[model samples]
Target: MFKKFLAIFTLTFSLINVALADQANPQVVMKTNLGDIKLELYPEKAPITVKNFLDYVDNGFYEGTIFHRTIAGFMIQGGGFTQDLERKEVRDPIKNESANGLSNLQGTISMARTNFPDSATSQFFINAVNNYNLDARGRRPGYAVFGKVTDGLDLVVRISRSPTAPKGGHRNVPQQAVIIEKIERLGSESKAN
Candidate 1:
């Protein structure tokens, strides 16, 4: 009788673990001139934002883009401009998912928007340092944080430390372009970290 109970407990525990693994967040890798950065997105917390980002990834929207904005000790922004500093027209703006309870901690990725709150389209930024002020506060809308860097965070920090200058009317543009070669979704088994 004791052996049977132990067997049942083991089977239940195995099933639970499988479910947990199956529910793991989807991951993507952005191959760049600087280096590859792997990120895991929390669709459960910000479904709309994640879907929008994944759609851009699947459509190859981020390929050949340049990191158009960078600030030391702040964040690196990209996914909207070509290597030539031309802005690519993006799809309709997405709803602000900032209230999703995710913080803008170091390495976390958030939507880059204008002052109007819900104006986020294709542009996104990775926090190079803890940005608690970017989190949603009460009634004010903040940037929607949908993911975080899982690997190559040091590359992000390095990119933040790059020198910047005004270009095409945009300030803090990296003097040497950091090109995004491509962004690809990783299969569940393909997650490197």
Candidate 2:
């Protein structure tokens, strides 16, 4: 009986550890010229989206991209280009996890996709308003919202309100583009003084 009880305890402990790891793996930081925007990724909720974003971060794919699209009261997008509008080649597209229960609410981060559902690559956006209409259940499959801005909504708002410059391109073209400059990760271990 004691052996059986020990085995059950070990299984329960292992499950708990997995849950904690999932929660801990979601934290991320976005450093921009405007300011630093800290995000908490939801790999458990949207594994594909999280993996795509983290892959870019890990490979330094977003190092010099610019926020090509910024619409006040709508969203701010980046992670795809340089100040001169040069596209940074990214890995093949990722599966759209829009079916995930997350919403495209204000301050939430979502993947930028084409007409198709599974076309999201390296580009992403943050909603400046509660965009329930963009949720997956809408007529369109909707953008894959994988995370949210946890501590820098003000920075996002500021970027959204910045003046835009006219540019010829595809979706969310800002009249005046905001350059991303770079993206870096900040964890507790790195913060130790």
Candidate 3:
């Protein structure tokens, strides 16, 4: 009887481990001119936003895009423009998922949107510092926080600190473009912290 119980316990433990591993968050590696940044998205919290972002990634929409806006100590916005500051055409806007209970903490990635609240399309931003105002509250529609940077945060800092200047009526545009070479989804080896 004792031997049987031990075997059952061991099997249960192993199964639990496998189940946890199988549920690992979806991760993507973004190779940029500055460096590589690994992001882990929370599909459980913001399913719609994650689906939209993953669609963009799978479609190669972020490739060759430049970090069009950078505000030191604030956030870095990208995935919308080219090296020459030309805005790329994006898919239809997604529904606002800001009520998903995620916060805009430092290193968290959120969808960039217009004042319309549901205007987030292809543009996204990474928070350099905690941005509580971007989190939804009551009836206020805030930016949808879907993911966070799990690696290469230093590269984000460097890009955030890059000098900025007015370009084509846009302020805080990085004088030296920080281009996104590619963004690809990672396999099972990828894990989000």
> How accurate locally, in lDDT, is each candidate?
0.93, 0.81, 0.91
Which residue ranges in model 3 land beyond 4 Å of their true spot?
A: 1-23, 188-193
Error of 3 at 94 (Å): 0.4
TM-score of 1: 0.88
**Candidate 1 runs further than 4 Å off:** 1-23, 189-193
Answer with 1 or 3, whichever has the higher lDDT: 1
- Ten-residue region with minimum lDDT total, candidate 1: 184-193
The best-first sequence of candidates by lDDT reads: 1, 3, 2
What digit string (tens of lDDT, one per residue) describes model 2 on residues 30-134?
877677888888878998788778777877778768888888999998888787788887789988888888899999999998888888899999998898988
User: Which runs of model 2 end up more than 4 angstroms from their true locations?
Assistant: 1-23, 138-140, 170-177, 188-193
RMSD of each: 4.0, 6.1, 4.5
TM-score of each: 0.88, 0.81, 0.87
Which candidate's TM-score is highest? Answer: 1
Give the CA lDDT, 0 to 100, for residue 100 in model 3.
91
Question: For residues 22-115, could you state the per-residue lDDT of candidate 1 as single tens digits?
Answer: 4588889999998999998999999999999988988889999999999999999999999889999899999999999999999999999999
Candidate 1: give the clashing pairs.
none
Question: For residues 151-171, what per-residue lDDT tens digits would candidate 3 score against the true structure?
Answer: 988888888999999999899
